[model samples]
Target chain A: MASPVFRGKAITYGDDVNTDVIIPARYCTSFRAEELALHCMEDLDPEFLKKRRPGDLIVAGNNFGCGSSRENAPLAIMGAGIACVIAKSFARIFYRNSINIGLPILESPEAAQAIAEGHEIEVDLGAGRIRNLTTGASFTAHPFPEGIRAIMAAGGMVGFVRARLGVDAPAQPGRERKRSQG
Target chain B: MGMTIAEKILAAHAGVPVVRPGELYFAGLDLVMGTDVTTALSAEVFAQMGAQRVFDPDKVALVNDHFVPAKDIAAATLAQTMRRFAERYGIRHYYELGSSGICHTLVPDEGLVSPGDLVVGADSHTCTYGAVGAFATGIGSTDMAAAWALGESWFRVPETFRVIFRGRLPEWVGGKDLILRVVGDLGEDGARYKALEFVGDTIETLPMAGRFTVCNMAIEAGAKTGIIAADDATREYLKGRATRHGVYHRPDPDARYARTLEYDVSGLEPMVACPYSPANVKPISQVEALPIDQVVLGSCTNGRVEDFRIAATILKSRGVHPKLRLIAIPGSQAVFRQLLYEGIVAVLAEAGATISPPTCGPCIGGHMGVLGPGERGLFTTNRNFKGRNGHPTSEVYLSGPAVAAATAATGKITDPRTLMG
Candidate 1:
């Protein structure tokens, strides 16, 4: 598989930016991804929608997605054109949710602390390497395993599972995987 | 190498002799859950996956608690989608509006969980079942969708944090206080991606309902799950409900842990998480007398009968303040019926509390008791995040039943002990 890399300017925030502010419950009833992006971070940083450039990445302290299991948080972030998130840590469900949705996230307390807002950064997802171009700093994160990278590369679990069940270009994802419920 | 009970359950499901933290393993799920809030999206994803059917009907539970009784067209549509999916798939565990409650409590109450089970749900509070000694964790809708197709999902074995509680719990102080104290001490991210194994003399004597409360908020501290070994207390609770015997597991004496801490609950008091963060907890005595506009007494967290009993005791003869709108929600239909049979609902109603049907309505700010702008609410629910209950300008403060009941009576945050005395 080819190594995937992401480059973006960092938009930094402090610790414990929970999921509620990411996509408030008022909007949790489910809307199109682009529609949800309009309100992303409306509560925490009303400026987020205006401040974010396409391909901008979020850098934050610990527990970046800390409350609620609404998958909307990651979807909103991804829809907002954020390339990835570099944080000190993430709430467990949020971490997996991001992966499942093909939103790349890396945990690097070192990079998260040192990178200033608007600093340009580069990440090599396959190698787990981070480069802070502004500060000339370098960091390492535990890279995703081959299987997870494959999932993300295939545009997330939906597409990946479709491929796995041998459902080809003509049909839906995995008809061969089906069994009668009892 | 010794392993925690969570580790043991994961290993057994993963078809491995042992497991280590941070390594990915695909494990079979004993159960999977979705709610009205999540299932519509999951059903969509499952279709997108092109799977023709669910992995197993018996292992899946679809509960319409989050926004049920059809809060609006959108909520009703979600429930309708879930109903359609359940009927199409021949799922037997579908709990519709009247039968539904908070998915976390409803799953356990229905005997769907057993010791050593591996469970996942689209909602974060799924970890509540770790009280039954299961390795249960919350996953996203897509993950649950995949599980419905494949009967399993991959997981990174979490490191364990052993919390040993000592000393006796004082009156009006129970699992909610203890877990809040744990959250306050650990900070919101202290246990990120890790299992919080609760063990101590205090937990051994705590009632099953209290144990459920403690594990329910594991998400507040960012724990993968909060677990307790199923013992006599667990057996007593599961006696006749569980059709199959659960695999009782015990932590190896030498199980490795990321951290081990001791909490002396003997001196503990009723604690509350102030506005905007579950980790921002303060003992009731130390907090200011912040007046409240509303008080909510239930959710997946503290909606159990025991919780109602505690709150009913405090609000029994005392009427709520005229300015306060006190709402009580039993966690499930079963709990609601119990409260009704015990005449607790009558007592609550007479005391100016509105007794609502069992649904997760107000907790997620969906409906039932939404706060208007500038209003503040004291809740026994988890996650007091901004805009969590209603208007963005509104605030949410979290407590257990005792504090919720007492605060409703006074129209301000008050220590339940003071009211009791």
Candidate 2:
């Protein structure tokens, strides 16, 4: 509620971290949230799911999310409670998807190399700061676009849309939009 | 005052009169798409928004190719979710593991797209459809869901750049190399969001497969789509296909483009897109000597049967290098059967190439031949971005299937031209 707090350790990687490896082509069938979360990073480090803790930050090189543009890759990581991602750069599609889902993806070349895996860290969006609790290092990431930040502040695109229309949340298995005519 | 083919299409879809370049036109989208990941989340968003119906189910398509053949329990669940959403929405076109190929190829091949239409897919390479002369581009999944509900989307009318390939291509120089050279000339992102129209006699001579290869990498240059006017070749390719959809035409002779660059195809040698960027291209001669740990020959870009036949001929009686792991993935089940029937599969198998099911496999860094740390790979896929095939330190070299096959045999980069000789 308070700027969506994120507290976790960090995992590091270089540029062009594609979605296929993050979620894998094999696990594409699973739709359950819990199920998808379990397969995060099965390729880079088979033990990643076992070893990762909630609120962990994934640090990587440029062009993160370079191929396919699958949303599952980001969902799996975020659903696993990854606090945020800090990369040198990100693919155009993945970057926008992360923001729409209310996941924080920070870009900073220095921040990519500043933290080590398992090092407790906190990301404060309001202040645009990343606090490495273990190393006592603080890094700054560019502020999100105002419109994007507004969506994230509301929790995600769905929440933002609902808030924009001043409508009550609906509960249903699979319903269509009343505004579909637009 | 000049307009590009992309500009012409966007103008028609813009709902406004006379769209000019550099003007932001929030044009309505004719089609919006989501694959495995976005489909599930978008359904939830729909539920939260109390939406009872999509704007138009006919315009929506869903496919599960990202995590095909479900490597793990979680991925299988994601695929199921996408399948459920496609079914519940009555999405007319749905592709699963057995039916799925890369989304870019699947869309056009299934006849879901046509020229002059504006389409947006939730994947970057969605630009592939631009080969058909559609003003198609990739957008975020969230953007796609918005379009699903509203049937509208925004765009900035882009300027156009003309790429003209002239002269005859050497036998071994294929579409893959042509695009690589294009990427080399135009730095990655050089044409970001621009429309690219390819011209010249060389383009006329190249087959549809080669045209697709060039269009497939339009995204690498950050172009909205790469297009060539549909000619006799286009008519021939579309002749037997269902005529229910697709638009084809040649650009107006007076059509305006922002800039034009020309190249000679015969002068082109095999090229590779080095790690971290598709634009980082080098001739095969420069990198052909580097030892490789893997060679992959498939993807939407170069996974067609013609690519395989070309590779098979190069691989006949040749064995994979002892140190190289060569993986061959047919683009689709159709191609797989063709290879099987033609005995091409047998020859490839005898050459020590590991064959995988017809899925995107390893092209997007998925399962089936991910390179280990510091490992170098020569692949026929479109991209060679850093960490694209597993280890960030691993090097990926993008090439034509002929080049991949040739390199697999020597364990080092070798020119496909020599193999042809």
Candidate 3:
């Protein structure tokens, strides 16, 4: 099972970190997960690679991912192995995208201020807990709704659907289901 | 206890208890559409999830747009991903690049959508479909993957804001202007978590293209979706569409709105969205006459037959200023072919304009018409955000196609009203 708690350092940004800046338009056509990871945060800090740790958390102001509804932006972050993000608020698309990929995202300006770059921290989803390992300061997060948490715990929506419907993984090849009625 | 258009649509589709604004509800999404850029990723996510079959392949629309001619190998790969996925899933509504227009424009034209249905697309501009009375908005690829696998998603029903555009609009004033004015009045986040319903006589008189323009920019104002009640134009637009598609309308005589706000259309003027933000709007008259190096006159916004006709009228017999690199890109093949048949293309060329293939170029700073360093251009595209048209230093001012043509002819920020009379 994936860890319910995340431990990491911190990276901060201001409001409205649009999709264009997160992954830029030039990299939009590329489908390889590796190439996108290289471009993540390149717009804001070209040398982010040298500064980042594997489990570092990103802290941002309101409306992060406020521009295009591109999934690559969040996918790049998750691919790069960043553990979580705490922001004042999030663009609706980004919030949904982060959850869909099983990336933990918390909304708390207080915790955002408490953590600093290179500072160690821990986050627990089920318990709605966040702890700064460096300073020993702990905070709380709003746990996901029961249904959404179940889906997240299953690793994503697809896993949840497979489990609930009792369908085999990858449903049988050459088996196309008819359109379901609304 | 007011209900939003999103809530109403969900309630109607769910066929259960009433829903209020801000309340979260999970419902089966009626449709999910995507262009080349989106479908490719969605297919990948589906594969990662190990889902062999989509919840409803028939309801999934795959349109190969964004990079229409397959500009490079990467774009071609994305398009190919969509093709293979459509073939594997037995998707019926796959639109090839040449056959399709913009994804948002093509959805309604193909008759796959209807009123009161919840549509989630991977493109931000997908909200444009709300003009037809559907509760359409954008989502990301991952959320779209959920919709693909389960045929459903959750939404926080938004509050409703009734915007009444009354009286007659001035000649140069149009849909682009109306939407800009609405943004000005409401501020960028004023309508956050709210649905906008355009009502009153002025909106009733506007054409379908005009209504689409208004709905397209609803996202800029932070609204869930901008909508208008279905009327004669809606009926005519849907008349020739296939009968299998669902048709829905607003509640009769006693319809209710949460918060009603009115605007005097007659007082509004042509508007421009300054570089760096869509919310920074100013009257076109206030924009100084600065020389431009480029002029782009097409996009999902202001890229229709009527838009081209008005532009052609302005460009008739007048050559584009030698200093300006004028470009016109039709929104769709139909618009492109029709402009050629109607000789609008000849007029545009005679006026010294370069025509490009029908695709969104330079609107989001994608390939075709990137600006060089220190370049300044007047564009007919929506949103003139900083670096939107290539160089972060390049300045782009948003305007209607008519103003774009006029500016191209004069080589500066000139208004269409000056040339007309």
Candidate 4:
């Protein structure tokens, strides 16, 4: 797979952006990614869903995604077409969930502080380099482990595991199983 | 190098001679729990992964406590999915609405978790088990599914934060105050990805229920887990209840800690976490007399018999404010039975408080005592995040049962010290 570079407009937020603000508990009934995307960030920023563009970047202060262990918080971000998240720091579970779901997140206090809303930022996943086009400034973060980078490159843990196991895509419920016939 | 309690347990589960902080290892789980809201999604992921059967059905517990009795059609359907999965997998520890309580309370009460064991639950409050000296932590649904499939999950061993409480706690101050103070000092994310090892003379003297309350909110500090070295108190509580016995792991005397925090509780006052964040803490004396519309004295954090007993004592001869609605929920069927047997339930009922069955009701905004718009609630539940209870406009103040019961009687946030005097 080729190393990918992403460039997008920044959407900035304050510190301690909890999971409840990203996606409220009331809307957690569904597991479908896109269904969750509709309400993403609705509680904190009502305009997030309608205003978000494909491949938009999210930059936030410390403790981004701090509350619940709901993976939907990151899934909602990805489903809303966010390219990556850059934060001063991230809550532990949120960081792992983002990686498992194939959302690229960089921990760069310098970048988070320098970036502003509507600024165009470019991130090179392989190189760990970030350039703020609007500010004409650049920063670097620790690149993800090669194993983690590969998982994100493949779109997530499920895809990576499926590929490693040499299995077909997840089967629909109604499909006939070879074991049933045997 | 001396291993911390968390490190020792992880090393045992990983089948490795030793493990250090920042090193990743896949550890086998002794127990994997899922609630009604999260189990359904985990089951879907398990099926999607094309796994034939659970690695160990007995090790998994599917609890139906989050939205019991089905608040809505959607909740009912989600619960049904959990039921189907549990039955299909022949999972041994399936507890439905009436038979179950909150996952954190029911798991330990039912002997599903034991000291030195590694446990993972889909709910974030799973760290509650760490009070018993187990290495327990919360994971997402997909991670829960992976554990169900492989009987193991990965972890980066967390550095330990040693918090030692010195001196006796003041009257009316307990675990709730201690944890709130630590969280307030550390900020919400102070211990991110770290293990909080609570130790000291004060911790050793606390009852098992109070210990659970302290560990339950470790997640509030962004901690991976909270631990207390198993001792006589833990052994006595686990007597006849734990499936396994014998040597439980404890931290060595020289175990390395990322930081050490010592607090003296001799002069501590009851604390409250104000609206919007658990980190917004203040002494109850300062926030006293703040009007409140509702009071909830239940959750995995403080719904035990001890907590209810404290509330019942205050409400014994007092009538709750006519304008206020008070709801008291025991942590489990066992707790409810104890409250009934001891007449605590009756005291609460005579005071005009609604006693509900063991469920995560109102804590997760499911039902029974949801707040209305512009309303204020004083609760004993963990987490006061915006819109956590009901309306986004509503505010919640987190407190212990003593304060919650006193507040219910006064229709405001009142100090229990005043009422006791």
Candidate 5:
């Protein structure tokens, strides 16, 4: 799988956007990714689901995904057809959870400050480059380690581990296996 | 080179002579816990990963606490999934709705964790086990699935933040106040990816329940885990409940620290974390008389017997305000039983507080006592993030049991001292 080069319109938010606002605990009863996506960011912005376009990028402030260790927060973002998230900083658990689920999130302290809502941005995961098309400004984020990049390339930890154990085929970027139990 | 307790525990589990911060290793876990809300998903992931069996059944515990007694069809189905997974895997420590309490409390009460052990759980409050000197932290369901599959999980050794408490705590000021002060000073993400080592005279004298309360909120400050060196109090608390006894480790006096904070608790006042964030803390004196619609007095953080005892004392002759709704939930069945045996339950019931089973009711907004739009709640549960209780517009203030009881009596956020006086 090749590293991703994403270009999308950015939906921005401020600091400390917690999980409760991302996906409230009430909707967490469902384990299905698609089901969770329906309520993603519903409380914080009731129009988030309706307004979000496929491959849209979320640009947010520091400590994004701060409360609760719910993996559904990232899953919902991925299921909402979001391509990636760029934040000033992320909570520790959410950072790991996002990577484990193959949602590429970059941290650029300058990206949120410079980018405006509905700005079109380009991201190159391999090069760690984020460019704001609307402003013609670019910023660099810390690149993921080769191992993690490989896992993300594999669509997530499950696919990564399956490929490592020879139980599944090598992953193709952006292609995820259906998460149904046989 | 000297190491902190967290590093030492990680080293032992990783089968390495020594380890340092920033080093990643897969360490064997002594215990891995999950709740009904988490385990069902983890079980699905575990099956999806094609793991034939759990790495070690004895070291794993699955509890039904988050949606205990099954609040709805979805929650009941989730619980059923976990139950079947436990039965199929022959998991030795599965606790059903009536039998189990909160995972964080039940694991230790049942002797499932001990000092110097590496522990992980799906619930973020799993760090509560660190009160026993165990290296415990929370993980996501995917990581939990990996741990269940391999009996080991990867970790990045965290920098240690040394917090020393001096002087004696003032009356009515307990772990909740101390931890709130820490979060207030450090901010929510101040200790991100770091381990907290709580020490000094005040911590040494604190009861195990109080220690648990402090450790339970470590995650609120973004700490990977919070630890206190096991002492006589810890030993006594774990006396018959510990599955194993072993040498407990403490930080070397000269161990390097990322930062050291000293807190004098003699003058500390009861505190509250206001709406929107746990780090937005202020002394109860500052927010006194803020009208409240509800009061929640139980959770893993302050849901122990001692907390209820404090609440009962405050509510003894005083009745809850007619406009208020008070909900008291015990952390575990064990704590619930003590409430009954001591008649604390009766006291709360007579005072107009409704007693619920030992589930994480309304704390995570799952069920029971959920708030509506424009409502405000004062609770003992950790995390007051926006929309945390139930409705997005609803607000929550976090405080200790004493303040909760006082607030219930007056239907407002009142300082416990006002009632005590």
Candidate 6:
């Protein structure tokens, strides 16, 4: 099987950029993707919508999503047209929530440091390869393990679990693999 | 060569003889908690995942606390979704608007948690259960939905960072100061994805309220959970309180840790986090006579009955500063009742405190007393992020209940020790 690689322009941010700024509590009462995307980064960068294009990825400094367990933070980013987030590190819940929602994220201090804002970059989830097309810098990140990779390939935890339950059959207990999306 | 308490609990729940960090395993959940803020979303995800019925109705708990008194039409609808879902599934542990306060305090205060249990909740402060030695961590609603269906969920075991607190706590210092000191030292991301095992002489003598305070803010430093071993004190708290047979797990002295952090609290003072970040901390002695606009003394962080007692002690004969408003909230309904039974509520009211129902109102900027632009408020709650209380230009400061009350009396940040004299 060929490695699944994602490419996008890097939308960068600084360290400890917390959840309140990502999807402020004012918008957190609901989790609809479309509604949250409109307000994503509205608190931090008022022009995030104008600056971002669909399929763009975010590269940020240390501890990207630092506060709040609201999954809206990641979904808002996804809803805003970002494909992946590469950070120096992520708060535990943000990291897990991103992955559970099928949003690919990686931690690479080197990549987080060298990648310039709006630079073109490509990521390979299986090979853990991060290459900056503009700067030509290449760094390796910790890739998802097999189980996590499968879950992500199935388009997140809900879809993954549905595939495991054989598309809504109670007769079979769990762990039956099904074909997944790209 | 041996496991920490967190590792042991996860291994046991996963039905494994042992486990290692960075490895993935499916662990059975002992309890699953949700709130109005999270339950509707998780129920939607649960239905999408084709989960017809919850795996165990008895293990699920749903609370209406975030926008609880039904802030508006939307919040009321959210609560209705959670209630209807609970009724449909026959989930027995549901708490209505008046019955519960916050999910974290309500879960353990009602004895839904016991030592050495593997628990998960939809709120970030779910790590609060670690006070009793349970390996509880927060998950998003989607994960909660998956757990609702499977009674188990996948976990990547986290590395353990054991923080040992030594020396006697100084007068006017409590667990909030110690944890703030740790966060100030560790930085916001210092404990990312690691279990913080707090042990040593201080923890051995600390009260259950203080222990709960310490573990509650593990997330402030980006930790997966903060844990202490279940000792005699834990057993005493659990005696006739916990529903299940609680098993205490001890870490081998030789347990491998990612790192070890030690703090001597003998010289510690009340610590405060200033402005847009919890990691931006200073000892209250260093904080100058900064005036405040509001003083909110509640949330999962410092909203227990003991916290109220300390606040009432300082505010007994004094009144809230004429310039600022003071709001006191108990952590849960039980905590509120205890404060009332002890006449602490009357003292606070006489002191000009606006007593309110138990909810995570202003802590998350949900309602109650939100700050205006250029407004600065002090709170016993955690997270002083920009726009956390109200306006993006508004400011926030954080401390324990003592500093909060002292500040309330003075209209500026003041030390509680000065009030004692």
Candidate 3: segments with Cα more than 4 A from true spot? A1-3, A109-122, A130-139, A168-182, B1-4, B185-188, B242-247, B251-260
Poorly placed runs, candidate 2 (over 4 Å): A1-95, A102-156, A159-182, B249-258
In order, the candidates keep a fraction of the true contacts of 0.77, 0.35, 0.47, 0.40, 0.54, 0.69
Clash pairs, model 6 backbone: none
Q: What is the TM-score of chain B alone in each candidate?
A: 0.99, 0.95, 0.95, 0.99, 0.99, 0.99
Candidate 3 per-residue lDDT over residues A82-167, each given as its tens digit: 88888776777777777777778887767776777677888886676889888999988666666567778878766776675566
For candidate 5, report its TM-score: 0.96
Top DockQ model: 1
Q: What is the C-alpha lDDT profile of model 4 across B145-226, one tens digit per residue?
A: 8788878888888999999999999878889998998888888999989999999999999989889999999999999999
Candidate 1 residue lDDT tens string, B133-180: 999999889998999998999888999999999989998899999999
What lDDT would each prediction earn against the true structure? Answer: 0.89, 0.76, 0.78, 0.88, 0.89, 0.89
Q: Each candidate's TM vs. the true structure?
A: 0.95, 0.78, 0.90, 0.95, 0.96, 0.96
Give the lowest summed-lDDT range of ten residues in model 3 chain B.
Answer: B246-255
* Model 5 / residue B261 / CA error / Å: 1.2
- Evaluating just chain A, the predictions reach TM-scores of 0.85, 0.83, 0.83, 0.84, 0.85, 0.84
User: Residue B44 deviation, candidate 1, in Å?
Assistant: 1.1
DockQ of each: 0.67, 0.24, 0.43, 0.50, 0.52, 0.64
Off by over 4 Å in 1: A1-7, A127-129, A133-140, A169-182
- Residue B176 shift from truth in candidate 6, angstroms: 0.5
Ranking by DockQ: 1, 6, 5, 4, 3, 2
Writing each residue's lDDT as its tens digit, candidate 2 over A71-131 gives 7677888878787888877766677678777678887777777777677888886777888
Q: Model 4 interface RMSD, in angstroms?
A: 1.7
Which 10 successive residues of model 1 chain B have the least lDDT summed?
Answer: B96-105
lDDT of 6 by residue, B31-69 (tens): 999999889999999989987889899999998899878
Sort candidate 2 into its docking category. Answer: acceptable
